[model samples]
Target: MTALPQMILTPLARYGWATHDAVDRDEGAVLRELGRIGEMLGARIAGRAGAIEETIRPQASDDAHPRSLSAQFGLNALPFHAELSHRPRPCRYLLLGCLNPGSSGAATMLLDWRTLDFTADELRLLESAPVLVRTGRRSFYSTLLSPDHAFLRYDPGCLEAVDARGRCALDLVRRRLGSGLSEVHHWRRGDILVIDNWRTLHGRAPSRPSSGRRLARMLIDA
Candidate 1:
């Protein structure tokens, strides 16, 4: 498989995110563009099996869950973290496009691991620390920062276990990577954002009571 062009890969590695405004807003055209990009990156665009592709919006039931938007801060919603971070072969990228920006407040935020300002000690701690993550009924262990590529597999939402040092390291990372280091993207119709899921953390802003936000999302893997 061919690798992504350096022109695209460079910014993705350095910033962890990129955006493009589409002149052709038709769903078919947008999808074709996405497929072209995915092919160049040697990735296949995927969605949840058995699910239909459509505009995504917040649900009232999402509020009932502690992890939902209603429970999170109005301005800064908790990030999705790494849903597939712990997997041996995790999703490599995420693509989200706005069909409607919505009258209700909703924006996407991204944090680049490369941009985090970590002290030498904190970095050392993160490199060596282990953490437990739980998804559904399954549990597994992984380091916050991988030794090989410094890849991060942190999901504050799914964190199940951590020791004192690990906890401290996580706290420091969260504190530093929060709103301060995040880049907020206010959606506009036809705006598409591509993210390096392995190297960045992403979240959404809280939606208003009657938000009209609609987005189409796809995961990509090589």
Candidate 2:
């Protein structure tokens, strides 16, 4: 198995993400390893956290998860975005444990928001831009960037720009992808990734079609 030589926790604080290889590919064991990491971080499983199975190739069209990145983009590379940005407080940490290594090049992609090279004007406009965030159960308004320049609220599918500046901010970000410190990690059975979802934007890269790619997902709060 491809395990990290040093402690996995080091990278989390440094790069906003880290990965560890488990002893087995079994879902139960992988999940246990993830839970252990959460404990070490003084975090707890999120209220809505649970397992998720990811397939690179569509199978029978998953209506249940019609809005999922895989369901919409298939095996193609997905755009970068923060998870559950529509929520009042987006998920803090995202854990993904691999149960199967489907194929090569279909790695998980990460980009730190701090690396975005935006001009002063662009940053100001985005920080003041109002956005309409809506989900089936609720709707609210918030800025694309926090006043303190901390959390970036972004989710292409749910966040709608409410003004011209908001629209411009969205467009500028779309063009700025792949310009920062981007990292891609190919999945291997027994590999588990811990992402500081709040500080990082993540998506998947293009890969060969395969339904064998499976990942169990969980959310954590510190």
Candidate 3:
């Protein structure tokens, strides 16, 4: 892994056009510096700062290829999974900047592999040839109410892995997230949450959409 920068930018709480805007008319010099710093940190952690370029994508929508995708709720609840696990390509780093927040229940939940318990059989299953995971039509098990959106499928093949341990490590992650949970962090505007897409699995808790839009931009570190 490359070395990360000493400077760290915490997520902000308040919202403003010029300050947080990605394509602001009056962009701040700090934004430029932040991008540079992002490059450095992303390279160190993910191996390529530019790995998440436009040729690849993170969203399921085909119309507008946005590096950032806004997640909202419909009648059905959303399930938890990595950003993109089905296809061959996925971004290394996912940066989420929350624009608006809802009521108390909208928490951003995640299952960390660092501190999860794994059974021997589950470990064997995970270590066995990468488990074939399919999303959408490809999935062996069908999910309810086919989403218009594209969700990443995480199976054994997704890992560009060589050793069994690497495969096993990822498998352990899949085993733990049997069903989504309610534990999550509620986002505040200007709050930027950076997730190691490969290391962690994330999900959203059920909530009733309120007055404003919970708009957010997802950026690949590259």
Candidate 4:
């Protein structure tokens, strides 16, 4: 009998995705590995990379996904949304590494726009629209549009909308919640998953304490 080909999961045709086995216990090693991968992938996809480093810790890093937004100011959740960082320079690649893997309910969820339900216009808006994102008394301009990326911050204070280019992306995302695009996977120790910020969104489910801990290192290639 012939053996099957190794089932390697690539991010997508238009995007790049990858996962690496991890073994470092120190935060610095995790960050360094993440940066190395980001640099390599960013050079291939985005042609260049900005700065890559460990996200500064915030106050609400313990709550599930959105609730943790305050403390995880620059970190992203599983199965959540993404886009570019600055204007006209969408983030083309993203990399996340699992330093510690929690047991049970701490799975990361993912959603692909093509799998979500939306009208042609909604789709276009998500690809090229601007969003008004509020981080606090300080608000930064961003959108779901091309070349625009955002760190999924958990600041209820943080909100986003297209300045004037479009307004339906978020609306459609909310409306399409039940389309079954949701994907969930647990990251084991030494595991890494890289995603195309433009084509995928990720978030996480709640988790209870276990023998192992959960520390994820994340970065972007723009």
Best by TM-score: 2
> In model 1, which range of ten residues has the least summed lDDT?
45-54
TM-score of each: 0.80, 0.83, 0.51, 0.61
For model 4, residues 81-160, the per-residue Cα lDDT tens digits are: 45333324445565666666645536777766556555667655666665666534444555554443232211122345
What tens-digit string does per-residue lDDT give for candidate 3 at 62-172? 432222222222312344555655434444455555545545336676554333454655434443433334444553432211132122334332233345654564545
Q: Which has the greatest lDDT?
A: 2
Give the residue spans of candidate 2 off by over 4 A: 1-6, 42-64, 207-210
Query: Each candidate: what lDDT?
Result: 0.68, 0.72, 0.41, 0.50
CA-only RMSD, every prediction: 3.4, 4.2, 10.6, 7.3
For candidate 3, the TM-score is 0.51
lDDT of 1: 0.68
Q: How many backbone clashes does candidate 2 have?
A: 0
lDDT pick, better of 2 and 3? 2
By TM-score, highest first, what's the ranking?
2, 1, 4, 3
Give the C-alpha miss distance for residue 183 in model 2, angstroms. 1.0
